[model samples]
Target: MTAGAGGRPGAAGRFASAVFGIAVLVFVLAPLLWLALRAFAGSWTYPHLLPSQWSLRWWSQVWDTPGLTSSIRLSLIITPIVTVLAMIVCLPAAYAIARYRFPGRQLVLMTIFATNAFPRFGLFITMASLFYSLNLMDRMAGVVIVQLIGTIVFMTWIPAAAFAAIPPSLEEAARDAGAGALRTFFTVTLPLAAPSILVAVILSFLAAFDEAQGTFLVGSPDIVTMPVQMYSLIGNYPDQVAAVFSIMLSIPSVLLLSLVRRRVLGGTIAQGFTIR
Candidate 1:
């Protein structure tokens, strides 16, 4: 805590901070580093710091495995469908809650909040029985619905806050210039809130992409997604193959998150989470 000539903190503080930051970074990344090593290693035995042999054999084997490819395909197909459907269903509700003051408005917001507040697995278990009665079990529609459940809070609440944050004057100005309600919304209000909504979309996309438990409960035997495949891989295959698949599962998340990293850091998404 030594001070500089101008009374600013000295080099000791900077050095300590730098060291702490580096240590935390290493701690966070160490698991991924181990996974990468495992994915490429031909043989990594006890007491070995590095592999005796390194090859792309696990990558090849992961692709060659039965059901793995289709699991990936199902994830690809289902994740986007869930994302789009969520946007379609939740955005209008978000807008209505943000702009209007109806009788049940507060109750609706509370209901949205309650969905995430409860034990989600319990809710999913309850839904599984209902899905069976409705004949939705083992269907793509059921999987999509299961994925959609977790996404509703993010899609609705975040965008609602984003919409609420926009100035009334912006929409009024658009309306004053001969724009209709729909035109003003499209031209001014929506565009102003687009960044936050985009963040919600990304979050919803990732939620569906990573969903496994409910998907397995409803769609197993007939629909096996990549995350669900991880269950079988860990029990039936070598560690390296599972590591390769784990890395594959993380790629889309890394890429999509990079797009909103700046806004996320700047609090665009954080502001939405505090919605009334």
Candidate 2:
């Protein structure tokens, strides 16, 4: 009942919260920091927080690996193609679901959610047999198709949410002005949902960049991704792994998102409605 006693409990609660937050952060970051530290360490045959020596030797060796360059190139090429294909397929599909009332809508939604329950191995094994029969294995087109199947429902969600948020009056105004459906969709609908479109594009891009299972199943011997290449290198040259690829993988995400992270946090969802 005393004011001083009440303040004591509040202070203790704040202190507990701070300690809990720090513990969680340390738990999540410990492995990553350890890996980065080990990558820079010289003569570290054992894993430890602090290394006995430090050198850039591992970094240089990672570059000299035979298939590393080809693997990187393949990833760069495949990610964009898959991303473009995903957007093309998901956008119109999302718009239709969001704008129109149709039968089987619940089934469509249920089907999308159900897909995430399936294991990657189950899907890939079936795809492998079908693709092999069609002679499409290990090809770029096959990689795109595989990536698209997994991404269709996921990429559709954000854009549908984005499109649904737009006021119908805006599109109706375009129609009243004698604009055709196709013209209004491109000029009015797409621009109105640009913010969500950006989010969809980024998510799909990251998904394509990180995809491995489908790529492994259908990607020809000729089409290797960075993750697959990383797996290949892990056994043969474990030391070289950290020096080159970890930093490479993380750099783009940091650099690209750094500029827009504030907007993400600032609730800039309103941009979806601004045409310009």
Candidate 3:
């Protein structure tokens, strides 16, 4: 209740806040710390709080392992492609859902939500059967299709909300200035919605990037993504190697989010998720 100098929180308030922040920081960082220690530790026997020896052997092993580099490359390639494809397919639908009042509208929205609402393994199993019939099994396209399923709700829901949030007056103003419908959309509407769309894009990219179960079921031996490779690392390699791979797998998401930290933290994401 007390204020310190310049009306800031008093000492006791600051201390409590600091303690809570530190606790949260530790809670979040502890797993990464454990993973880092395992990746570099040469011998960390039980009962020891720290490793007896630290080395880069596991890191080296991660780089030297067969198919690891390709998996990383595949992930880099696939996630971006999936993001773009999701935007291509879902963005228009998002715009339609946001702007138009058509038949079965709520059903469409609920259907999108339903994909993520239930358990996914059963869906993947059903999809695997379809892929087999369609000859999509073990193919890049099939993997992309599988990953796309993970991104649909994000790409659709967020951007649709973003588009819906925009004022019609802005687009009308652009149209009054002699801009055609498409031009008004590109100039006025798109820019206003861009922030939330970016949020959706990043979320979709991360969803596809981290997708593993469906990918493994569909692609198998031929298409090994980074997340799929994680299963192999955990099963076939030492825990240390798996830890190293885990860190590597995390790097892209960390860097991507870090680059857009401010934007993502801005109210755009909140606006996108808030249903009117």
Candidate 4:
């Protein structure tokens, strides 16, 4: 049979797929390109396809901005704390959901998924008054707590899936070798699930670091995160400075993902499914 008549997609199909992929790439990258341009552009009036001049003034402004430094520091402190706390709270719960056939298991899972599915703004609005009453408003702890609601839901589901992918037989083997449940988990199950756990940690950090609405609603003025600072700057300052701040805000997450890309991509969630 000819190549066109073979089971493979025809040239037209390949062409269509390529065109679609290129279109998607452009759609996603266009805004980022514009932001980058605006961040450095000195002047670009209407009808100009590109900037008439370019300068480092906005980049300098980003460093000079007083709130920017504080916001970055707060994000740095909060993101890691949120990631660790979410992992600590979610790990056992995830393991239980993965390993045990408990009452209300489906209900628990559904509740988590539902919480994640809900509109964050609505939740923030509803909780704002409650937070103030509790004296949690404008506190870093409150922002962390608010961010945790979504992160925990996400962190639980991912690790649960990862743990489920691990075979019980491995735990059995570790036990047969005289390892207790906790020891076996730390020794075998945890090592095997580390990659996925790392993914959860990374995602949790990003969620907390980039959290804007909740931070703005509950922690603004007292505890400004990078995203909240970006929003505030965009509202009050020039767009170019805001773009520079946007770039600054994105750098950490990009660096983090780049750092962990090797481990995440090298190890599979189902790595523990195999005997050896």
Candidate 5:
């Protein structure tokens, strides 16, 4: 009749929580399930809870679509490039913000956050003319640069938080052991931050991989990426093609997440450090 000492939920409360969790899971997965079904459905019609038939014809069409191969290749090229460049640029900036108390540090972080708050379509549209005038339009370089604007903002914040969570004593101890600042960073700080940095790498890659607005504005037919190709396919083909494209788009992301599952789910940059 009495609640648990730790205030744990009663059986009815536990049942409610389980039901709520299941509902949330269904809410998230239902659309993906529907898309998977439609991707294989030969002729799904209204008023049917399931497909009348199933086949791989849509998948074959997806594979054979002109420019799809090139688009995928371009995405593979661009995503890594963007992720590496973003890490290079953001890591030091994030470290400085997290470790140092420089003037205007908060202001700089606020600006980065504000940049992400702008509507991406409007932001890309405004940059489109500037990119064109600079002769960067329709180029891979242009897409990478534009994509970096948003990705850097997002990627920077993640590592910044990770770095901030780290105890400064770890770096200080390394310094006490006769390590130079750079060596201390490379030896202690970076190792501790690796998990979060890996997370940032995966996220940066995904952001660049999935980016549509900036890529659409800056890239040409010659520089097509997967999202751009998918847009074209959806416009010219049936909805099934869109479903197929969604599955295709998701595969690499899913694989990347799987590869980093441990780090993403449980590991942290500074998980084991103690302040003593």
Candidate 6:
């Protein structure tokens, strides 16, 4: 009787979990599947759930589109640049937050978290005017610098938390043995914190890559990106644009996230905040 009750509850829990998973999948997959079908069908009607006919006319045109290649190149260039800069800048910033005791630390962290709370688009005109004065307008370098300002907090904070989770005494031990700060960082801190950094880099790349408002806010027609191109394509050719660019825009991130997601989920960030 005891064994049967345990088995019954386990079976019920499994059924409920399965139902919830299927519901979530349907919600996400249904629209994407519809988009995939319609993109191949070369149709523009959206009120209908699915298109009746299917064709490859729109898919072929994706290659011939004039500005498509440029936008792709620009995005490919900018995403990695911002990710690299964010990672490099974040190392010291993370170290400070993790290891140091300073005035205004909580206030600074609060301010950084607050930036992600609000929509960054509200600052478009102000950011544009600021970048304009700095001569970043229409330049790839400018976009990178501008993106750097916004992404720094996310890039650093989580990694800092990861670094902090390591007992500080480890570093002290390394130092007592005569390792310098930089050497300790590379040999001890970095190896331990590497997976966190990888997660941060992937997150930063996706954040900058998908930024419609920031990209459009400071971006020009001269420097096109994938989302910018997709936006323009929506205005002109809504049919095929979703198909080709979906793969282009999605693959890098999907591959990266798949690799790093295990680390991210298993990370110290998963345990929530603890400042020491």
TM-score of each: 0.93, 0.84, 0.88, 0.89, 0.87, 0.85
In the predicted model 1, the residue pairs found to clash are: none
Candidate no. 3 TM-score: 0.88
lDDT of 4 by residue, 76-187 (tens): 8898888888988988998998899989998888877787678999999988899989999989789989988868865887778788879999999999999999999999
**Model 2 regions lying over 4 Å from their true place:** 1-9, 45-48, 256-276
Winner by TM-score between candidate 6 and candidate 2: 6
Give stretches of model 6 more than 4 Å off. 1-16, 42-54, 267-276
Top candidate on TM-score is 1
Write down the lDDT that model 3 would get: 0.88
Q: What does candidate 6 score in Cα RMSD to the true structure?
A: 3.8
Give the number of the best model, judged by lDDT: 1
Which lDDT tens digits does candidate 6 get at residues 220-267? Answer: 757778887777777576655666677668778788889887776775
lDDT of 3 by residue, 1-276 (tens): 333647768778899878988999999999899887898888899999899998888888877877998999899999999999999999999999999999988889988988888689899999999999999999999999999999998899888988887888888888888999999999888998887788788889999999999999999999999999989888688889999899888887997798668877776667655454
Candidate 5 weakest lDDT stretch, 10 residues: 267-276
Kindly report which residue stretches of model 3 are placed more than 4 angstroms away from their true locations once superposed.
Answer: 1-22, 266-275
Looking at candidate 1, what is the lDDT of residue 159? 91
Clashes of 4: 0
Model 2: pairs clashing at backbone N, Cα or C within 3 Å: 138-218, 138-219, 138-220
Query: Clashes in model 4: which pairs?
Result: none
lDDT (tens digit, per residue) of candidate 5 on 159-276: 8877887899989998998999999998888888877877878877888899987898788657789988877877688888889888999998899889778866674423312111
* Native-to-model Cα distance after best TM-score fit, residue 153 in candidate 6, in Å: 2.2
